[model samples]
Target: DATLLHSNGLTVLPTGTDNDITLFGPINEIAPDAGIFESDIAIRYFDGPASASCPTTTAAATLLRIEGDLIVPLGGPATSCILQGDILTVEYTDPTDASGDPNTVTDSATFDLRNGVLQSDKSVYIIGADMILTVIEPDWDRDNDGAETYDLDAIEWDSDAATVTMGNAGGEGAAFDPEPSSLRETGDSTGIFQVVIEIPNTLAGDKLERGEEVVLEYTDWGPSGADYVGDEDEDINLTIFTSNFGATVELDQKVYSWTDKVYITIVAPDHNFDSNLIDEIGNSAEDPIKVATRGTDIDPYKLVETGTDTGIFTGEVILTGFTAHDADGDGVEGDASGTTAGVGPTDGFLAADDDDGITVSFEFSEDETVVGSALIRWNIGEVQWLEASYPATGTGVVRVVDPDMNLNPEAVDNFDTDVWSDSDAGGIDLTVTETNEATGIFEGTVFFTVTDESSGHRLRVAEGDTVTAEYEDNTLPDPYTTADELDITGTSIIGTIVPPLERAPASGIRVVDAFGNSLGEISVDQQVQITSDLANGQDRAQAFAYLVQVQDDNGVTVSLAWITGSLTAGQSFSPALSWIPDAPGTYTATAFVWESVDNPTALSPPVKTTVNVI
Candidate 1:
């Protein structure tokens, strides 16, 4: 092996590029419509790459530069500062390319140093775009020879028609206007340049479809003259919705104009019912049908009572089931019974046909037993079907007829049904109601009971007294306190009637003056102070104090204001000087005097007065 001389070898080489240094000069500028000292531009590495030094000619390099201007300074310059409104033209180029390359392209950038720095707060960073340059120059002359002049250039300009769209892009009155630019320079790097551009409102853009524009106007309201700059240009983006125009659309069709009950339906692929009744429709189907009647008719699924001289009466409901399907190829049907099918007053038993769909109905009668506001609700449940057996060998029989085996398994279907009326039925809630029997005024007070919806506890509310109806309190039957009430002098109750009804007493607030006179008109800027034990933190007493300032047809506060405080029992308070009018004029002040204390229902009269202010 030693005799075999291996002479086939290779050598390595070092081939890499060196880093490069470059010159970076940023230019900052300001917008022409600068309300104050505003910078209108930003400096960025728009296109060129950073500088680089390479051992060879093939290396990456770039030059960093900036361009912009400065406009109106809100405040005057520091003391002794010579102000010059003449446009400042500052441009410089580094003699050597910072990329360390002998052959490199030159890039230009503008700079505005009116605010001492090359950048301004109003700088807008456009990721990729041409450089926009500007500089603020004072309208002053150093020579002071009675003649002052400065040269400048116009950077940008445009003109176009204002476009207005009625709706959005696809809506009405959509049009476009040509936006053009016009710019001119008075002198090269010396004099001031003026550019006149016009931006039309009707431009093409998704956001602009609603409303957008670049408005140009002369800040000085006086007639346009040759010496002044055109009104500042403004860019505003806006959006308006169809609903803002009073357009309305409904998502659901089941609407109640007056009072009709509505029920939802679900079905399987075919009109046939599921053997397991798994397709039966009801509460389990997850579609709770909303009542269509708008209070005029019997509440949906609720038993309502009809009034008659013979006494109170009750009514019942008759039910029928139907089937439907999904026309699309989604394999899902909207109308189908799930779990339970077929019906006969049995709970969970739906009248559904195995081949198609079955229907069943039940009639109820009105009777005195079903007195005022009472009803029985029912909700159908689910049904299940039996499955066929597997191999016959598992049953100890390999051939012949296996007693435990299912023959023609496909031919036989098993289903279960349990149907009946439940007071707490999950679906199809029903209510029965009748008119109050006891009429005519009562001699004294009537007692009643208010039971809680949750705990079933009873609380007594006097006649005319207000009480809150809440589900947490077992008052679910009366969703709103409006539905929960006790019969004052009637044998029949307005709400769900239970034993031991409670009574409620009426209460409210009122107002009066110190001399027992009704407060007429309280003057403007007048403070009506109410001092009494009632102001000593009584929970039942509620007092409001305010001053009404007189206003002219122009909506200016022209008169003194009126003030009011608490008014209860025989207690009294006095009035003091109120608010000072912003403008001098003759105006009337009105004070509304009232209390929501012991007398919770009564409202006090308003007091008004006229005052003259210089």
Candidate 2:
């Protein structure tokens, strides 16, 4: 039986050319960090004499990792030694194997060293997107280090070494050859040479399309007049990665007043890898987008790019409401309007009204088009209670939105509204005011009273009564968006229900400060108020006695305090009594509500809680 260790001796990276074969492994892959460095790992020319690229009989590997490809160079533009029989061998020894002696392991794989190799280094080639492919010439490494690196200025190129002839090899392959394109070196004599091939749409003419296939082939068959020795060639079969294009439309706001401007935005894709169509969009031969609302076209209002290269476009128009204010309606879209608004696109104009959707659309490459639409709506308002329930004595908070009144916040308009209650037909007439200028959110706080009618700060309400607040905008039509809605007269209603008499009067004790904030624990001799929420839920007022008692661990009452107060109908009030803990000990504080101190008539349940003094 053979002992197994965690080392993985051989693995090759995928990128290959005639020049190099990269192996990046043989570490203890199962180790904590996939790294167990050992000096035994080595690389060699499988079974050949030591050549210029290899030093000793066995050159073991040192860079052991799955990352950073460790390239092992092979001599060839097409070296005869690079035949199917030629191979690179890697070996490693694991001294820690279960076997008492050092265990040796070996692995090998064959790689290609082509004469003329094509390298794009991209997983995808998007059509209409420009890309560069490189052609590497033969390589020679006299230094016995398996890496294709020449001395400071080892190999250089100054002129055209060979002509590259490109042709299509899709569908039925044929001998249809086009004019030859020259292979340009990136710099002087840097073996890496580049060639530019245009896709069917952009720089490349009518040679490609969405569904069809386009094959690009470049060959250097003969040893030519270049800086290197042998000739190389490559066949690259590419399936055009075509994409269906589309766009989206949005408005600043869905609804608009008769005089409000409509802000429009359009985001369309140009079917390119990166946003390279900035030069063609926004200021294209024709308007990139079209806008229409009331059954007619509106001037495209010189759409502009949203950013340096975002492909998103935006344009704004003053809603001049009419098919055209005069006979100017039937004019053309930006077909006649200049590309800039400063100069004025006087011919084409669009006026929007509360009608069908405002449509903004654009056609992209091919006949594919994208359309975005939104309807112009009536400026109706909305009303909502901050919370649906509140005690009759607590404040009722309502938020109002009246586009007609809130539309202009710089003036900070305050509009009168009504908050009526079920208990009384007549209620408080409240005026709502604005706070945040940008959102124009109007809020009105009304202190609800049981039987008193109050102004801005008061709305008469009762226990279990429904408080209704209706903010009406007379500019909106009752049947909104109708032809009769030329006027805004919509009503927004919010009805809040006061908490009912779910339970009778109750009292509870909490050690609190002067501000009624609970003091979770008290120090010895600390004077704190024991408070209770005393409330009356009757149709008539009631006199109540609130009492608090503290008992020590011995069950003897150490402190007792009481208060008498009158609670109006549906009124919630708090009463407090002072208590001083004389010593550090465990105590329980209990509160009780009764008819009076003399008449011990319990009106509700008494509440008790344990308190710790530290």
- Top model number, TM-score: 2
Q: Per-residue CA lDDT of candidate 2, range 127-230, in tens?
A: 55544655665432222323232221111111121112332323111121111244454554455566544433422223233433333344443223321222
Q: How do all models score by TM-score?
A: 0.19, 0.41
User: Taking the candidates one at a time, how many backbone clashes does each contain?
Assistant: 121, 16
Instruction: Please give the TM-score that candidate 2 achieves against the real structure.
Output: 0.41
Model 1 has a clash total of: 121
Error of 1 at 255 (Å): 8.3
Question: How does model 1 fare in lDDT?
Answer: 0.23
Model 1, runs deviating above 4 Å: 1-458, 461-466, 472-540, 552-554, 558-565, 569-585, 592-609, 612-614
User: Per-residue lDDT for 364 in model 2?
Assistant: 48
Query: How many Å off is the CA of 214 in candidate 1?
Result: 81
Instruction: Judge candidate 2 at residue 574 and give its lDDT.
Output: 80
Worst 10 residues of 2 by lDDT: 152-161
